[model samples]
Target: MSATVSPDQLPLQRLYHWERTAPNRVAFTQPVGGGQTVDYTWKQVVDQARRMAAHLQAQGIGAGDKVAMLSKNTAHWMMTDYAIWMAGAISVPLYPTLAAGTIRQILEHSEAKLLFVGKLDGWLGMKPGIPEGLPCIHHPLAEADAKKSYPGWDDIVAKTAPLAGEPVRPADDLSTIMYTSGTTGAPKGVMHTFANFMAAVAAGLERIPQNEGSRMLSYLPLSHVVERALVEHGQLQTGMHVYFAESLDTFTTDMQRARPTVFFSVPRLWVKFQQAVNHKMPQKKLDTFLKIPILSGIVKKKILSTLGLDQCIFAAGGAAPMPAELLAWYSKLGLNIAEGYGMTENIGASHITTGDPDSFGTVGRPYAPVQCRIAPDNGEIQVKAPWNMLGYYKQPELSAEMFTDDGWLKTGDKGSTDAQGRLKITGRVKDLFKTSKGKYVAPAPIEDKLVMHNAVEACCVTGANLGQPLALLMINAEATAVVKNGGKAELEASLAEHLKHINETLDPHEQLDCLVITSEAWTVDNDLITPTFKVKRNRIEDMFAKNYDRWVGMRKPVVWHG
Candidate 1:
């Protein structure tokens, strides 16, 4: 059965519902230094948002004005979004890790009336992007130095009168303009309405186990569509308790504090967790212990407790394709991570696995109310749903191009559907590269295999116009530590063996020629990866395509690139 949405289910309506019925319920838990934390109740959240909304109105922010937020996920981030909506303005969220040039482009293109700068790692680098004379407010958690440079959040809230009465927006009113984390080209602003977000949340709640008091950890950048919809909108719709992670260094500590019942993460972090576990105990030894029925239960409980996922009733992985091997590994550890598929255009609500063992490789069936199909000509996956974005902001022509003549959103991913309607994404339509032998190769599947080894952190498979494809690999922390301790040769041998094993399973044309260990790291700062840790294939081509032939010519299974 398809999911249905009602006007009462709107985000603001839900916020009002909780404020009246569950005023004392803890809405957010924010970690401070020295193992300290701060909590906000439903009434407190609404009260502060009301004050901020009045302040915004006083500043001339009216209906449809774009108010952008530049910060990591925090309680104030949520409060700021509510304030923007309450003031009848559309919210624009920028990824905290964006480059200054990109930030300027979005702010300029969005015509944002104001920017709210909150928690950030590189505020100094991002500060220059805000246009001069542009009104700005620094959140309570903004960097100490940056906090002094702008109007503080607390001061404004303290002095301003709370906006009287509940200021409601229409369900059709535009809620947010989410900029895509560009992997192929320049980012596009995806426009979503309040109704659209509510519909997506309605569909999600139909399947995912979430309700009032369901705990969630909001560490993924809320700028992303999935995190915003699932973590923010999910919390509103269900009155769930949301917790914020302080920093990367305190991620484990933060997880323990929240002990979230609902968790979502990308493929990279899942692999890292696996690596961390293997680093402590060899996988083979763990497998041996798992064979003992009595010991297996004890072992799994201990592992889950250590990772703070002991209470995780529903764990999901998205933003990128998850390795099937990784899924099996987590399943073996008693944590069934349901892999889902979606994008910024869909509010990141589309398909998700439902714990079917046979659905391991596929992303599973479309959510209730989401219709999916494969295009006959290109095999690109297409979807139609109530939650689909209204259109791209201000880019009418491009927005029109994103849909089919029949109105389905073109996902640009090539995949086949199983008999039961599950989707198995083969690769992106634009990510395919033709070799000198004229056979086109898809890199995502091969790249997934390469990351299964604990030594490899991130890798890209590309060798367009070359006889065979080759991979650019960046070793993980453990491998780097090992190499620094005069174990480079041992690591090289291990990589060579891993490379050969992967190549043997591929078709002749799809087989990789060699694995090049890159000296430079692929990072968000380098424009080599998106904030979500998905590699930018176009950027990879620009940076390393010239070295493909040279590495292949070395005639070794593994080649170190300086």
Candidate 2:
């Protein structure tokens, strides 16, 4: 990777370059008119972005001002992001799934001067969260938010002329202030500069092969660093065509339409895809068919096409650890899901699998010019990279604590490097629990193992001060429905057998003493899981803390029906 990058390498400059070099090349595709779609060329994207930038400038929102974007992933969201940077402002993104309280806190904390609302599912419900005095701009596709008397997209574009200028930002200029999802604690504002994003995009492109004409589907929240880097910055750098998912109902259809060469998703979605396949064809039967020569080839093609992954060159799972069993299952069907590791602090630059079968269960080696080490005392992973964040916004003390005296950013995840430099994440350093027997247990790896069972949807291992660790199991909806019928006894028996199998493979200290089955579902709305679908261990522990003693004292291998 290049040690020194010019301003021309930044996203805004790349957008202008693409417009001049490939004016008519399709830049984005948005679903519209129910099932139809609309395409935006490179020229169109640049023109609209410039128009929006001019509008912002007319509104006295310029250089160093903060602008917030609240919406689901959409074409307008990308356009507005570019406009904010083009207007010499910082973009602040809020997840569409965020609660009203969170929205208010972020807006007030970032001191945003304007908000661009677009393509949200629950805009009416979230309306109460928006500050009364703040001004708003509605995207063309934001029907729900359009019901209010906010400035509309067409009005802004029609009344303002395109901003006329070359790139105005230096490499160190702040581009965005991204709020971290508060899984463990209150969210912090992570600031990333133009240089940081450029460095990360350049480093990532060196490892992951993407170029002009490469296609990607943008369904994940653009707010997250992973999607922002890969879809937004990656598109600008590589001139890739991006497609937007209209809704959850149309995700499969949209994926089929784009036929993206590179696809990415969280582990939770991958699990749901796996379950969908297994529901159609029993695992045993699928395994038997895959053992046959010609039939195996046909089965693999059919499965990939059915899931709209037939054209996928690189598929990734991140934001949480993916089970080794899940990886192997996909590998058998010719889809190698590369597991990666990174955090918002680093602009999602850390480790990624080599797409090799042997690289399974490990987030592979660091990118070029990036260095990583495990802290000796607590086994916490630490990294030093050009793409690391400038600092937490307005939190000097916290920012200082995030890095070592020598400047290596301290990642709170506990992990160790293999002989080949692959990273094996154990768990969060703060999430480690100590049993009454004085043994420390990392629940993440064990929980990953438990969820491999077909009946399990989510699992949490907690016994911070108890004699032995206990597993809280949330059954999948389909499995729960089965249990509701006459399958209750049978499902309990099977879960017990599965628990015994899992415990046999674990160390005695790490073994789960009992399993508590609950029918209640954990979701982002309920605070049991983060927006990225990672289970909040602390929240789960707190929810069942009062019953932990009794559950452990039962002295039974399976404490069924909680």
What is every candidate's alpha-carbon RMSD to the true fold? 1.3, 1.7
Misplaced by over 4 Å in model 1 are 1-4
Worst 10 residues of 1 by lDDT: 1-10
Error of 2 at 264 (Å): 1.0
CA lDDT of every candidate: 0.92, 0.88
Measured by lDDT, the strongest candidate is: 1
Candidate 1 residues 142-238, lDDT tens each?
A: 9987788899999999999999877788888899999998797888999999988888988888889999969999999999998999999999999
lDDT score of model 2? Answer: 0.88
Per-model clash counts, in order, read 0, 0
What is the per-residue lDDT of model 2 for residues 185-281, given as tens digits with 9 covering 90 to 100? 8779999988888888898898777889689999999999999999999999999999999888887898899898999899878988999899899
After superposing all C-alphas onto the true structure, candidate 2 shows an RMSD in angstroms of 1.7
The deviation in Å at residue 424 for candidate 1 is 0.5
